[model samples]
Target: MAEDNFEAAPGGFIPGPISSGRGGSGSTARTANSNTLLSEQDVALAAPQADAVPPVIQTLRLQAEATTGVTRGSVSGGTTTTTPVVVSLANASTSDRPNADAADGDAYVDFGGLNGNFNAGSGEYLQWSFAVPAAGTYDLAFGYAFFSASATNRPMRLEVNGKIWDRLFDFTNTGANTTYSEAVTRVYLEAGTQTVRLTATGFSGPNLDYLEIRSADPHRIVIQAEDLLPAATNTTATTVNREITLPFLNGKTPAETFRVGAEGDAYLDWGSEANTLDIPVTATVAGTYSVTITYANGGTTGRPLTLTYLDGTAIGTFALAPTTAPTAYPAFYGDLVPAVRPADGSDAGDVPDQSGWEGWTKSTLTVNVTLNAGTTVLRLSGAGGAQHRQVRVRAGGGVQARAGRPIRHHARQSHGGREPVRRRDRPCHRHRRRFRCAHHRGLRGCEPQHPLRGR
Candidate 1:
């Protein structure tokens, strides 16, 4: 009956033999029977091998019936019954918790709600890590949009790998709804995973955006405006007056001419020929004129030409030479000279002293006469009549002399008897003798008076 009951309990029963004996034999048979029973029990309690492990059994229990929907059920024995929830696997991290609906043998991580906000005067920043296929150049792109209307007042800058990589955008002046997208190519990336970060330095509002990176061709040329004229380092030159002849690169040609001054009273004129041209400039006031010239090959050159008034006389014929082309002609001519007459006590020329003086052509006489600190007189008169010629005399270095009036001095004594006689007791008077009697008396044959006057 026990065997039948044990076999009927859904598991197979163990077989046992009935034994009869006395004393030592009975004890031995009893020990053997006990061992058999223990062995059977041990066989039933032993854990199954991995290959013979039974499939997990799941039992569903209906907890409550919904009034207008399907009945809710609870599952046990390593099975789960819950609503399916999708989670992002790309951004999963080890510190995250698994979702409630995660099943056995399935990997999962918990991700909170996506919440991002940037405040005024605060910049938007992003960080990410990725793996690279190989060592080569990569293209990086960043796309951004304003979150709120207040974000329009902020300025934005993009930084990659702690280096600025795009043009800055001022949100205040660049409009509210403006979208910013930038792309930088030829960024060298290694053959492993790298962490890229985008930092907004100057943004001052709710300005946040997304960043994208990729690979692209590494070979390309970039041209900048400053690179066009690298050889044209000096943009200024000092020149006398407003005239300047700029020596350019051998094959360079002029395109346009421009002049800037304090007032619009300045102008610039270029030569008609192609190469080796002259620029004639004019300005009303003395100042630095910014001159810019555009070349024929779409390049430009700039220089400064100082314009000033002609102050001194410059004499001599200056000729312009022709180079590869005809020589450029001058636009204007000027001369600086005095326009006045002589001053007081100046020299005057007198009448002709010889026959050749009648037809003699008067050559300009420039006499630099220095006087002592005191007053002095210089007489000058034309060799002919007073009305025949005019005289001009100047004082100082470059100042012209004004017209002067002539004055005459009358003599109180005649040319004859100019010397007076001297006496021993009369205080040595100045003598005025009309003639010497020694030579004239002998010519007239007058007898000489003897030493003794009494005879």
Candidate 2:
């Protein structure tokens, strides 16, 4: 019998059965030839093309198998099965996954077996990519779950073009199976493809799952109070009040007028007047007054308005203006009093005398008369004893008087053979030699002469 030998080709080795040391039979030779033929065919198929490049495999797919509760690259000789997760990219600009080359069905690569304890503590995460359609604002949102752990500190962040868009979730000491959600405002995305990634950082426990993206719009302003009038100041004594025009007559404009009537005892009278021009004024005392006009865009714009008084007299018209918003034309007024001060000495009669002497009562009056420094005379009268009344005089300081006592001299018929004499205390005593007493027709001719008879 002849022996059969087979040589392996450069592409793959050919399998052959063990033979006895003696020569083989016809069946063994045929089997050896068959192996050799198959090897040769494989080598020919693998040879380089005219371009000197090996043939390219268009698609490649692989599935993970579970063994002993663990999935590995190597598997034992046993039956293996896998489920397919199909993913289709429509407007998607980018993606990050294994076996992305597979087109459909079981050709898709399987992500290795996921354990039940995947979360922050495991420091594990899955990432994906997306493309921005255009250069405009867009809103983005993300959702995922983490596993429970003693210190599950899982946090997720979003990045666009390698820049952190936002941090989605941050949790410490999370339970075994918890889910978290994150949302962000509308951001400006530039034109062209953008690399959007969802990263799980600070997670020390387990794995994360599931992420998605979508679109949104910007905000607007609808209400404004800029047209409302402000407060005005008045310097007049007369009550001159005005009304403010409603910038928005449709009633959508929110405005309030705070007028402190006039300073002293003044009050804001907001009756049923629709505008500032229509407000009626009651009588006010003569003085400088101020009216403060306060207006608002309600609570919307929160802008303050000012009420201004025009130039000239204090009794001019008032206008409403705002730092921002539409201008308003309201009523105005002028200062009540003229600015001039009255002149002094205008009326001589009105002037008061600053210098004058004051008088005392006559009952408290005293008289004082002094002779030369060497002599003085003091007189006492109205009380005396004599034939008639006589004035007494006192002298002091080296002066003397002829009459020491009270004396009287009068003319009368002789009594007891005494001759009639003139009374020295008579009113005519000083001129005794000038005149004599007259006799009345009676029993006695002349009695004691009295000073009361004359004068």
Q: In terms of lDDT, which candidate is strongest?
A: 2
Provide the lDDT at 174 for model 1.
27
Q: What TM-score goes with each of the models?
A: 0.21, 0.21
Could you give the C-alpha RMSD of every candidate to the true structure, in order shown? 60.5, 64.4
- Model 1 ranges off by over 4 Å: 1-119, 147-157, 164-186, 205-209, 217-455
lDDT by residue for model 1 (170-210), tens: 22322332333232322445566665543333233222223
- What is residue 130's positional error in candidate 1, in angstroms? 1.9
User: Whole-model lDDT, candidate 2?
Assistant: 0.23
List per-prediction Cα lDDT, in the order shown.
0.22, 0.23
